[model samples]
Target: MSGTLEEIAGSDHAALARWVEAAERPAIVRGIAADWPAVAAARAGDEAIAAYLSARDNGNPLTVLVGPPETGGRYFYTDDMRGVNFRSEKMPMAALVERLLALRGAADAPSLYAGSTPTPESVASFATENPLPVDTGVDPRIWVGNASRIAPHYDMAANIAVVVAGRRRFTLFPPAQIANLYVGPVERTIAGQPTSMVDPDHPDHARYPLYAEAERHKLVADLAPGDAIYMPPMWWHHVRSDGALNVLVNYWFGQRQDRFPFAALMLAMHSIRELPDSERGAWRTWFDHYVFGDGAVHAVDHLPPHAQGVLGPPSPQRDRMVIDYVVGFCRSGGSG
Candidate 1:
């Protein structure tokens, strides 16, 4: 019972807020966004959901990916790992809706997908119709397409993905399985983010035997319309859309720059990883004391506000200082 995500009834804003702050694992929030107009319209029919979105469409162009049937609707790197198998185009939300609606019955139509399209960019009033308990700072995005597959990836921000039409299946993995997951190139990516190289639907164990190790850490969730999942930041998730037409609305928040992982990672990579084995060992001790093993997550009672630059409390000024220090280091060859 302690290991599994709690299933709470309804979208209690107070309860959801607490979960966003303290819940350490993924949660299956049943009926959280069920009352959203878009979800309700979707319950009526596929056309209803499409029409609901189109009515509020802002006419913004979102990036859409088109993949041939040979790829089996899976967007991934080419067989040679040199490039992706999909072509991308900037399409208007309303037109994309029409295209998806038209392809509902086409068995051989190329996979058409538009993911991470901002709600404000696609449909300005979409969030008003589908309210979330999260802060306004959280950016809500729309995903629409016929049946398609999204490769496994982790986001920098915490995510709450709500299913509007059709069904979605998610396979999740914790960050601890990064090594076993066989991540793809950081430079060449299918989308803007790095994705797992191993295919979960068809794992070639011989080529990537460690991927089987990742399987043990996998958590599966099958969501219907009105269902949403609370995914903590850095949790890897693989999503697959089912049925003829599918739509998902997701919100991403918790994008705190003060928490400071990326900047620290870049500095360490430039300065530490290339060091001699013995020198690298010394840096690990310093990292433990100052970075990863820091007890800052719990409390700042040990230090006064004045003593804490970035650790005591969060502030925009403190955030700027952290960034400036990192940037200055990079510009000055890390000495000044």
Candidate 2:
């Protein structure tokens, strides 16, 4: 059943890290960044926060997506799904903030969003001034916008998102709800990841009947300026940013897979999806035994260690061999 997210206090960094690592579901951390300068600035007013960020601007132009008011701040595909509804503009962080502030009270202001901009590149001192409690190897990225809705999409790695300014609402669904979400095209997507066609805010139940099933498993979280949320890998989430100006800082970690799973899925679809039912079923069994199933560890135990190759174990040598084989196969036009 759908429910509100569990709340946790981010007082202890070690405890917070442990909890985040073991969490199977998403959790909202209350006032985790209350002491941050950005949050303080946001509390003062939208103009204060804008000035704070602009002061740290590195002068690099960030690509901002601009969507007309007709889309109602929801950036997505056009009617025919041939192209996106938003046009991208490269502008400095200060300029973008000024534009958003100017249209603050407008009833039909165009959606302006600058997503996944590297904090160090755009705002030179942002990372240093507002450091995350725990280290996430990769640098944090900033998402700045004004009153926008992003479709439900899953990330490949685990994420910790902190709301530095304004407010955010996250509607989350577990990975198992994939089938019911009515996912769009994988290759041609609004963003890099394939997003759900059904809008969580206003689901078209008639066109998407199965979304009702997905709605049953939904979990919602409303985050304020200093609040934070932790999401595990592949948890589908639809995000809505409220207020005239919003800023979110997020860190993505635990993405060191040998090969991207989505790329493997695309390759399998090309090679195996159109096969005969019997053949496909047999391949499924093989995949289960060697990939998804627990018995994969011992699947090649019967063979000599020297001859086991990629099936034997996860070692540097085996990983290199697998990579070489894949590269060779692709280079040979998949003849092998």
Candidate 3:
């Protein structure tokens, strides 16, 4: 794949600028230029190498990315990951091999991997081993596999993903940047992880007119090892592993003081949106007076109140509750 930050010129830049402003999406810088060494070291060993090979051969949906030639050309395509089951299972070499062989010639069995990250199996195991925290964070975990494609999805909150081995391609659009990006049907059971109906090259404009708008604001990044990508809340991104053994550790972060816009939206949804329409008027007034305020009245002025009562106390209980709710929402198919 092309190296990170493939900036388009002239009209492309103008179109991108409009899209960025319209969508308020996050920014991305490619060729971080510093994360390569660690990425190389991590993939150099036998155990790690074996883990990757096993995932690849068994149809586990993981992928790997090697560096570009110093002279520079597209990175090599290390594997094909179109159909591996990343959502349901990840197992030993033998089991994966068995499953792949069983499906061979039986039907349209595309010998590749495709599915969500933190598959159902992984989530279930995580929930039991380490209860998700409320208003806080989950226990840190590292995910390594091959050819897995995290379909078009938006993550709640903020996240930083570090590439340990291999390369990845990420296509991102802002949450508010909705015109050209097709949002998937929201599941009643799960929430937060919204699906994007975007397919970079040939997007369906008739069905999803907004996607055309989202497309105008598109940004693409091809990532390499040691490289970490930060996805701000509400931004939509579709990830495809561009290498053989792609190992990544994701850090899901909490809302920070600076991320008040997201926090305000979250707060408004939980507090005011729950109120009856007539009653909600008062909250809007408050929001206008406090959040969008007179030239000088900013959101921080209202934070003290939230810190005291409106949002309840700042403790692990609330954090855990939020985590559990979100996790459950995902498990139940919020992004289905």
Judging by lDDT against the true structure, name the best candidate.
2
Candidate 1 structure lDDT: 0.82
- Which runs in model 3 stand beyond 4 Å of their true positions? 1-38, 41-48, 51-87, 90-140, 188-192, 256-283, 290-336
Number of the predicted model whose TM-score against the real structure is largest: 2
What is the Cα-based lDDT of residue 301 in candidate 2?
88
Q: Listing every candidate in turn, what is its Cα RMSD in Å to the true structure after a full C-alpha superposition?
A: 3.2, 1.2, 12.4
User: Which pairs of residues have clashing backbones in candidate 2?
Assistant: none
TM-score-wise, the better of 2 and 3 is 2
Ranking by lDDT: 2, 1, 3
lDDT of each: 0.82, 0.92, 0.48
Q: What is the lDDT of residue 245 in candidate 1?
A: 69
Residue ranges of candidate 1 with Cα displaced over 4 Å:
1-5, 134-136, 258-260, 294-321
Per residue, candidate 3 scores C-alpha lDDT tens digits across 1-336 of 212343322223344344333434444433332334434455574345344434434233433221222301122122352322222334544344344444434434333332234523332232233232122254433454444455467766666555566687788776666545555544321124545555554566776666665666667777666455656767777777644334555656654643335454665576577888889988778767644667423444546654533233446765665566656866887662
Per-residue lDDT tens digits of candidate 1, residues 114-156?
9888888889988776787667376688999888888899988
Error of 1 at 66 (Å): 0.7
Could you give the candidate ranking by TM-score, starting with the highest? 2, 1, 3
Deviation in Å, model 1, residue 204 alpha carbon: 1.3
How good is model 2 by TM-score? 0.97
lDDT, candidate 3, at 38: 35
Q: Is candidate 1 or candidate 3 better by lDDT?
A: 1
